[model samples]
Target chain A: MDKKKRIVIQSIATLLQNANLKGFFTGKIYTGQSKGVCVPGLNCYSCPGAIGACPLGSLQNALSAYKFKLPYYVVGLLLFFGTLLGRLICGFLCPFGFLQDLLHRIPFPVKLKHFRLDKYLRYLKYILLVVLVIVLPICVKMTPFFCKYLCPSGTLAGILLSFRNSALFQAYGKLFTWKVIVLAVILVAGVMIARPFCKYLCPLGAIYGPLNKVSLYRMECDASKCISCGKCSAVCEMCVDPTKDANSAECIRCLQCVHECPTKALRAGIKSKPETSKPSHEGEKVPEGRMRGKD
Target chain B: MRRIGTIICFGISFLLIALGILDHQFQAVLAKAAKVCLECIGIG
Candidate 1:
């Protein structure tokens, strides 16, 4: 059921990401006012078909111009998404995350368990957020270091759009060569490790990770119904043990565990408390269903 | 306590967004978006 929902949501997100179909064919970007607002996902702002700004790109641009103005709007937008949905955006909305999911489904040899190195490397995203996205852009006079030098999403978008315009190949240089190498590494690593970018290097994920602890939408577990089967932890892609910490910063709220639980102990919702109801109330003696419904 | 914190954060974010709209900051964002971002296109 969750897989079907994921497919539907991913399809809609892909459509929204490429809503400007004409731009894809013409090799032109959407210049409408809608482009001014950032999408709540890791989409490339320069994608010819992208109709909205990328939050990471927008943040860097605002930071670059910090000497003259404050980035209240972009910051506010980021805060809104973070506080409301947290990494649910990463799980359900991000095109790059969706791409990683598709790649992992290709029947390749994948890393099933987390390693010590992986845990340590997860902190790199925060460093990337602090340095490339914020520091370098401001220091280097408005140059978006992360977009130009690092982001595989931007590189992939540039590649797709460049295919539409052969003249772009003529303008490619050393920087583009470096970006291609970076994109290649990320692509190969993505196939081996689930969400390598989100787990290790996406600055956008960095911004949303800490917010997951306090986001309104959350994962909750009913300890009373839990059978200690470790199924939820085993199914988690991000190496989070949902039983130990249902609202872990690493959890994307994908609901795979909620679907897999035998006792129906796991749930994802905006509610403050985890529901502890039995899967079937037919055996209860007090006709508790009607009484509970009143609450 | 956490719920209250979340509400406060949301309130601050909404206020800032409203202020941005009133200040016409969207124009600046539009100006940035109208031009193709060279760095993002892998040319700059």
Candidate 2:
């Protein structure tokens, strides 16, 4: 998909998920029947306009109540989404991902595509998934650690809701301040980097990342048509080489590489077999910086 | 094989979602989501 089409899809998805317009004016969360179901992206349930539950938030909350029973509904919904679309949700649905995309579009002096720490930092989201989203919630009863402490979407919701609710504003403490700082840092980093949060911090992205390889909606590279022109890699902000690994976990299915491929080697769809030609740089250790799109 | 994997995943997810509903898990989610979610908003 082109940038404009993707942006439109993102906007529509965001609007549909948060369709409770009256709640925004009233400063109240939607308590409708739809709230029981989970949205495919990283939308916060506490947001005044949210009509559905957030998958990660529901998972953490369910884990907190683990002794009672497993969170089958939330886990099943997550698996359903992962198997169906993988990080395609991150690519075209997530409000926060859209926000990051918009922020990255702001004209900036320096755009850091890759740094020395990039590879190591990519593992942080997985660590957070295992720790904050699962372990801590199970250990501490009824505490959704990720939502309370780390979720910028939740923080954003709090900020938006507090604007109309004086009581909520009065309840702010150091935790809120800390969350605001985290949000500020992430937003600023997003301006310099394409998707710093999705790359290094989002637990939801971590969950969907590995599923990209097996998801029904997947990327296929036709080796028979490849010219090894390296245009796909140059255009990928996520630092994935579509020719080398079309269904890479790091790919969010942005389709920029597919659109940019001069030879039309890369295509994305459901149930297509991916074929990769030998990379020109095969058998040689590529420098980390160069491999990850360093300028 | 990939198609089989996808079908199996779909089957499992549907079964799990059904079982969750039977277990009244949907009600739990609804109840929690209906509230202000103070912790989520960083108010509690």
Please list all clashing residue pairs in model 2, or write none if there are none. Answer: none
Q: What is the lDDT of residue A109 in candidate 2?
A: 100
Model 2 per-residue lDDT tens digits across residues A1-295: 7999999999999999999989889998899999999999999999999999999988988889846588889888988999999899999999999999999999999999989999999999999999999999999989999899889999999998998899899999999998899899999999999999999999999999987866888887766556699999999999988877777889999999989988776788874542233343344433322321101
> Model 2 misses residue A174 by how many Å?
0.5
lDDT values for all models: 0.80, 0.87
User: How good is the docking of model 1, by CAPRI class?
Assistant: medium
| Model 1 lDDT, residue A16, Cα | 91
Candidate 1: tens digits of C-alpha lDDT, residues A63-176: 787464667788788889999998999999999899888877777755555777988998899999999998888787778899889988888888877878888878888888
Clashes of 1: 0
- Give the TM-score comparing model 2 with the true structure, all chains together: 0.92
lDDT of 2 at A122: 96
